[model samples]
Target chain A: MVDHVGLLSAFGLIDAGYRQAVQVMEEGGLDGSTSDPDFLVATGSEELRADIPVLRHDGKLNPNGRHMAQQPIELILLKQWASYLALPVWLIDDSGNLLYYNEPAEALLGVRFEEAGEINADQLAEHFHTTRLDGKPYPNAELPIVVALVGRVPSHDTVRVRGLDGVWRILAITAFPVEGQGGRHLGAVAMFWETHDS
Target chain B: MKVTLWGTRGSLASGGPDTVQYGGDTAAVELRGPAGEFVVLDAGSGIRPIGEQTPSGTKRVDILLTHLHMDHIQGLGFFSPLFDPEIEVHVWGPGSTTLGLRERLTRYLSPPLFPVMLRDLPDVTLHEIRPPASFALGSLTVRAELITHPGPTMGYRIESPECVLAYLPDHEPALGVAEFPDVPDWTSGFELAHGVDVLIHDAQYTDDEYKSRVGWGHSTFDHALAFAALASVKQLVTFHHDPGHSDEMLDRAMAEMSESHDLEFELVPGRVGLTTCVD
Candidate 1:
């Protein structure tokens, strides 16, 4: 099993630039400020006016840039840890669209990353509605990722998902809803696990 | 109101010396309502004897099944009343995914499984219980709650003018505990069984056995005791003894269960031919 704590630590490293920007805003007397980017642009506050963009080398962010501020180093380390963990994770919107998925998710769902790219959470929910396997209709209320995005916290339970191989596999899907400032719904993070394998 | 144990064996029926004392019949319970109205719990093997004893007449036998576990419905094939042209039997149970109650029962009672088909049986009506609901038979009121089990099993509460008896002979408390977090607060089953006169519950496993078979659709004697205490029931009869337990083992279990709970309720190990009056 991949160490979850180590994986989280790696996430912190990979998103270091984003993390530092947030920290700067928090410490630069911008705490509790709800000014939009347009408003900030117009105001031209001296602190906010100082824009810093990390330079990139090829596809990766350059670690040794004057404006990089140690964030890129942390980001690279976090990405390395996350990739090593091989976690089955995905990002979905409130309307149940698949926004992003990791490599492990592809293996768990038994679909090619390219093929799964064409499908989304809404399509999956629709498929569940019309499909009948093992002589039982798929329970709509029991769908984990959908329930999470729709803000319905289901009790901890396992749901059966049919794989491409025509074998039914139980999956433990946990949804964590993401909320922004003023509790504005951002999206949701979903984690899937094979029941027996877990 | 007389409640008779037509069948008391849990799981499968055992006919040898080991089960002779408690009676080897599986899951059938007959409740005689006011004016001698018959309310059969399950049609397990015990129903064979009940069918033999119930006089052949144009009387309607009301059969209420908790679920369609083989041991619970196996005796339907041998229920002699179905063959009697004068008798009209009403079978009520939960519906399966694809079939209604009658259809599901017929699947088991028909050709390949049985020599006699259900459609060919004389004067039988089947009702499928879909949601949690109630019904009235004469003056008695029957209420059912969908319980947590592998299949769609239900716990029934029968109320009359004089007494209230709650029968939940096949339930696993942990399943309920998992669904409703406030289960320990005595909310769900207690609300239905509150102040009942007699609470006959599923006590299939001891506390030790429950640890291994947590979600296997059976409850321990401790869980039953706690429920009876929460419901403030007058008497608690532990039904559905694990097939492995002998008469002597059950006696020891009852004794161990009574030591921890300080209540003025009678704790009895249910036996065949045992009769109790509700009123």
Candidate 2:
């Protein structure tokens, strides 16, 4: 073990130079720098959320096949269907974990689905800061999406949520449970559209 | 601790004259602890031979499956102990949200696919394991974690009194990474493999082949070497040989790879019936 550790430290110097050479070649030998003005502006700005993880804004790697491989086929299809629809849609698994939300939904959520990544049911409920129309904190169990997820039933309601940008919006949401051919409850889908600002 | 590779061929089992050197069988491995504890990893077609070799005195055997890929579990029905009423068989595997291990295994083990049902095998127990699960098998301590694979796959860390071994037969740590081998803590199977005595990892594709096969749940040799270096593993057993690669091609590939990279650790090509001991 001691010998291996010693060898690892010695190899670090060679490995670093090797990787740098590979990177230089991969970047077309341009010194690994970008001269794009848009990139410079994006990096120079302060509006970019410092807390958010870096995502490839182009949505190329967002929700790739590997990320969806373990999900039920029904849920996978629903995610695909949501991706094409202009309406905002949120897909949650049987455990009510937030699997994904479409681009339109991303706009309303004030964060890209890639940026938020996958959040558990509990964390998601808290992340959205959902409340009833009466200005009271809404129980997660009673929320339309959670109700659909838990009961395998359709649910609809109007609720207020604080987006990631700290803007509160009143939205109308309809959620329905998704079931596969063998009576397996795959997951639930929630479609929402903004009605007004809260 | 003794680690034996019963199978190394990936994707499919291709037994022919060309593959005799590497032994064409899908992923099945046996790890024996010093205290007579027996553990089998995967039930690929290679497991048929392992079942034929099982000692009669062995009362219990545990099979830890990484995932339910057909290539990984196709030999479950052929495993001899599952049919023996005297021997206890325990199968552990990852489960998805809608289905548990038993339910998932039932899909392949029942009816039209196979003549017998999973339940028909007396004394066979199926345990649904979630990642980050730890358990003890006699003298061996095993830890399982979800890895970057297409399905609900797991990589295992087996620690015996004498040594530690990591098995990640199918993985793609560079799937979405801008740059791979970023850090030991950030890599997929690094946690299980870090500083282990032996790291049996996926090296099913050449870097050229991997260019077109990204996100296919396997690693290139370059990625494997980088990962081994980052983890500081003492011995790296390059596993999961591509079914298309014959002995000659594999030898040429390895020779080229050796010339290109400055390796710091012992590199061994995984092969059937090859046993390495840690004491």
Candidate 3:
């Protein structure tokens, strides 16, 4: 079995809540009268084994490991496997800062993960030239990503944005808040598909 | 449905001469059902008045509390209906994962906080409720949505065949760093109050007070008015008057306000005993 301690800390999942959750995971599980079961571990405790080599490789590739420490364990799992998905994935912390995006998402943003270290929610909107799907005015606060982070509820909306190629892409996005135990918000993730005119 | 503003003062109870006109009870409102069923909102000090007004033969009533803040629930013990065996009051409120509504209410309803225990109230049934859920309250379709607040807070929309009335007694619709994890954005408030005939909302601050008190989970009169206008609600009742605000101060908040030519809607500062019919 992987050393849960080394794996969690190595991934830079270093928030106080995450640490407290790990402590519970070590002592026992909340299913059996665990004290102060604050956070829920999205990933199981089985780690360090050669079978789960992807997490190890991702930890090595994490440019923002120091920053990832602030994210919840569930978010860490998203960071690890989100890039592998065929769909473009965008992740933001509970505070609504752009934490990371998959390669496909980066291609859409026309920026790179390494090049753009951290961007606030507002700055990302300005960079993308986001607008309402209806071609009407859209407020920064009402962005699907912002709604997901602020409302802590799953939201789906279509937005028109000027992509890097100077083409207006109509993207249908569904965003849901990442939460730990007791409904504590971890962050939010957005999955999107760009509709093209044939 | 007929609505009565039994308690309008916000934060704390202040019963004095200055508050006589608006009355100094904290958040409680009662909606007399069209078919004689009882539906009440919150249990603040205003519940005492409801308990007194309730007739003994009233068989069933549902109390949907917005949250468990002290000011919102301090009058529960004083509410006499819980002691009567004849009335079956079903209490519903938002609950955390670790605690249900009844368990969390023990914080104030138990020995240390009050003499009576929830267990003693055989007539009262506490149900742990979450929002984004809708349930039928007799003929009225009641919808509850999680709103922006410090704890697990909720706002409600009550609809009848005749008209729709949305009540958000304790809410801060403005966006800021939220304390709770899943608290919805300000748009949720607009959605709840949208297209309703009467929107009774928290107007607990002035524009000046709201500056320093931003993110405190309360709204100013301007915020309340703006929401009522945006939602296109027919009438707005500025509720949850600040405890420090006297009847005179409340009068000025509404008296100075006028309906713009572009936006025509009736605005009234809420007062205890003022009844508004949802028609």
Candidate 4:
């Protein structure tokens, strides 16, 4: 009989409990030769590893790692492009918690995320509202992360909250939903462009 | 050489007990240079006293005016020199908006405003001025610039070998478009008056009064300071005092004028017969 569960374990797909199943499959093999099922399972694991890349310390893919890792060339290019364009880019989860922010975002907003483990978007908006020169409420509907989480795609040139050193600044915001592995919706990535008024 | 004011009133001359102390005559000043050469700035109601002071003779007179404002031109008919045929008075002023200089003077000197026409005046010639121009008479070089006033008015920068004096009697600092971009820093008149010995500027209102009377073609003392400081003048004589101001009020205003930055210029309120040597 073909032991599908044991084949998946040898390919590093199953959990630790599947180790006995893999031993039983090896004993059943008459000449201890690799079968078509085992070969198919190994090939599937290689393909899966190739499709999802692991991030390195420098935010690029580690090519020399033992695990099959795909290069995050597109993500690295996006970060570089965002910085070059002078746009603030940030990733936020469904609960409106900031997950990641690019260099431009730190420069424009004047917020350092080096020591920050978690950031609440609503709290940040509230703080911006109180400190802004115009002294107006920041509407949630106008926030890019808010719109993206609610499954509503915002139009281009939408203004977002931006205040720096007692001066009011205008920002254009856009958001896109990010889908991770297993078709899971990770959250949204928001891009901001600050416009200065002379 | 000496320059003495006989009248400094503007608009309609208001003569009353309150105005009598300052001699409520309309704009007139007598400038006497060396070799007996003399000129008058304006002929307002103040010309009566100036006429009384003129020695009885056939001496020629020169009269220069900024405009035909009633207070500026009214004294022409009353001046004693125009009555003498041998006096040879030469009257100069800014050209009229719709009429020539002669015609404009004629309209005022004719029947409606006065009994005599300008043409009938004996030996008096009216010359229209092309301002932002300069002319020389004896030892004095009189330069006129287009100043901001109700009609076209000219601010004069009279230079003698001894000293330079700038006279902007009816200036409105906020009038017209300020050619330069910055407010409180740039002034067209200040550029024309840089480094003068004395600046006689219009101080027609206090800061409080100026708020209600803005665009009335006059300036306050604060506006005067901005220009005077920029010009680096030695002495700033505040003139064109508002008719409503009292002697006590003027004293207070003069006291507060020193609160400005150390520009090393003396601030003095203008009064009739207040004489100072130009040099």
Candidate 5:
């Protein structure tokens, strides 16, 4: 068994917080050893993990470890992966429900995911005012997230979005459908960065 | 409401002496309401003849495409009204995550595929539809809903003042399930087809053929009948015939199905140029 903790630590990927979490996990009788790095990434106990971002392995996450009986593992992994991303990331379900947006995304949207919760596709359209580069109001049908949710394809476009702060920001957005094992459409994820002002 | 089947064949256009009785065109169906609403269900090769026979003084025609599969949209460029600047041609298709309707259609309508680009076409407008959406074309109200298919495909429910007609030419309502018509609410395309006056649905394979081609996004006659029964549709017009099945084969299959099954609704084999008035 390759010690994942020592390996990730050797690569300088683990910080002080991650080391402490690992120490606590080891103290709690987890054995804290696995041949596969990904297995170690996926099976962390909830209380020990806390808010510390853990990299996913082979598209699996078990925040509640083997006890995760509810949400799909793929989504849990994606949410964790997104949380660690410095770039703004938004995760939506197959039905177009807003599932999660990371801390970086919350800064840009001017709201937190906990407060916003799961916004349905229809309400999402009303929440953000989007416009095309030519200043025409962007049709909901053309939005990258809408396209990704409906068409199940990767889409990229530049549009202006009005944040909750009432400021319009030009963002070059790329959204792609996330399909799980056996070609199941898990949902879609969108990552956008602020571009030049409109 | 008057419904006309211009093309009944599915997959590919299999025109030959063997297909003469049933017609070899792909899926283009035309619907007209008493209030003068003209709608084309798909742009399959069958659409060519319908375009040739377009009524004079027709101002606008809405082409509601279920999906962008080649057999479905093959007759689009050949549709004459797209060339007429005097008429407005609206092509409504299922939206994709990758490209807009115009861009996706352009791949087929332009360059090495075809001579004229979708952009070069006159009086042609592209409309992207996200299913479970309701819209109106004149007096006819149309409800588009996403169904179980390979891509972003939709089944349409068109309701007029007199009658309701549902069209789901390419659907697999029993993809994952072991026993079909599991639950009314859980069945794919159930709501669009439920209790409609007429349902034109996919019957692309026989039961045995479907076993080998599961998840191919087409329904077997048994599956279609089950769907129709669950929806309580008054008349079920079997559509999207497999390209390999000859007229004689289809006739024999239809006969076998009718003889073997105790069905509740009227069943009719879809044939090109068959017209029905639902009242």
Candidate 6:
């Protein structure tokens, strides 16, 4: 339950890194900064259709995967790290709220968190119908993300998750637990890629 | 009854001189009843030869598919019977929870992946058949039992008055012991193959290969041997040959397994043209 406080900004590391990402995104789509790895934030900058909300009421822009008190230094860096990359990144608090995601993920979710307001995991699960690569559904409890939470271990699963567009894209999802402060559990993070996108 | 191994290769169809002896065609097996009835086990690349040599009398081709994996259904569009106006192919297979056999087949058989759609194949009629059930599809009494696979895969037991032949082209017996937690132990493999005239079981992996690939839905030769022994099958034809295994590799495997085990039944290597009398 211990979320390491201000590890990134206290060192002026990810704060500078993240703001630079937003700046690059604002300039143009992902193509603007080919030199920088995080330039992918630029790809969907025009589409989110709203500013990154300053909703500090619960310290989350949206009720993402889960809710919790603080963001571990790893999760903080994770948030910044996800903000730049091209693949879809999703982070949850210990309480299971959707905390942060990059622009590439915004395109897949159908509703960008910026304009759509705060949405919880329950809401996001609605957009996805999880199944195997051949379109066979696993019992919800046995799904890879759920299994990681139960096992407290990192897990990789390959399944097709359909977004709101009703297009079932085969995604390889990797889910891992976030640990901080003498190995206290914070939450989980997942990075997913549409297999066919390659 | 007569059983012919049209294609014995698993996963993918690999061709070359290396695989020519056992054949590189994927999953199709031709079963002929003494009544001159025709039944095809799967539609793997092996079905191509079937299309070319198919007899004219039986216009209705009974294709009992185990599951709709690409390797199992890859040769569907290329099959010659589908192009003929008079021939009717009755395709039978298991469906996903929501999708019927038609919907599942149409997923791959239609445009983008293939130029022809299921609707265009007017002669082919798809039927959804759930296992833990039995049905008659001619003189043959067909019993479908679900197997330990990654999906809703069924290993069939085709019985005639003369004898019974069980076919499990792709199965993971060890997985039956550990997975499917919601269900009780899966003994379908044993139930289907037990005391049967012939058992065409999946022998895609070696003992070492099975260790790392536990849930891959295919069995090692050792596991297949042990299973066949326990079930007391009269004849064991190790089917679903791994694509990477050359003919020499298969011969070595057959010899190795034969010499290694003092078994009750004869262990035979499944070759493309190999035919066994189901008596």
Q: What is the DockQ of each candidate?
A: 0.01, 0.03, 0.05, 0.01, 0.02, 0.01
Model 1: share of native contacts present? 0.00
Clashes of each: 4, 0, 3, 1, 3, 11
DockQ of 2: 0.03
Q: By lDDT, who's the top model here?
A: 5
Ranking by lDDT: 5, 2, 6, 3, 1, 4
Candidate 3 regions with alpha-carbon error over 4 angstroms: A1-177, A180-187, A190-198, B177-186, B259-262
Ranking by TM-score: 2, 3, 5, 1, 6, 4
- Estimate every model's Cα lDDT from 0 to 1: 0.63, 0.75, 0.70, 0.61, 0.77, 0.71
lDDT score for residue B72 of model 2: 94
Residue-wise C-alpha lDDT for candidate 2, range A125-181, written one tens digit per residue:
446778898899776556687556544568999998887778888999999988643
Q: What lDDT tens digits, residue by residue, belong to model 6 across residues B1-279?
A: 999999899999999999998999999999998777788899999998998998776577888899889899998888888888888888878766556677788889887999998898768777666444466667877766667677778888888889889999998765534332211112346656767889999999987877888778898998788778766789999989898999999999999998888989988899989998555
Cα deviation of B270, candidate 4, in Å: 0.9
Candidate 3, residues B1-279: lDDT per residue as tens digits?
899988888899999999998989999999987887688798999899798888868888788898889888988888887888888988878777577666798888888779988888878777665444466678877766666667778788887878788888888765342221111121446557767889999999988988898768898877777677766789888888898999898887776665433446788779888889655
lDDT string, candidate 3, A119-190, tens digits: 654555446777786788665445676556544557887888887657788888899877643345567899
lDDT of 4: 0.61
Global fold similarity of model 1 (TM-score): 0.59
Q: Per-residue CA lDDT of candidate 2, range B226-262, in tens? A: 9888878888898899999998898887787778888
Better of 2 and 3 by DockQ: 3
Off by over 4 Å in 6: A1-198, B176-186
lDDT of 1 by residue, B163-254 (tens): 77888888765443423323222233543466678888888897788878976888788778877776678888888878888888887888
Docking class of 6: incorrect
The Cα RMSD of model 3 versus the native structure comes to 15.7
Give the lDDT of residue B2 in candidate 6: 92
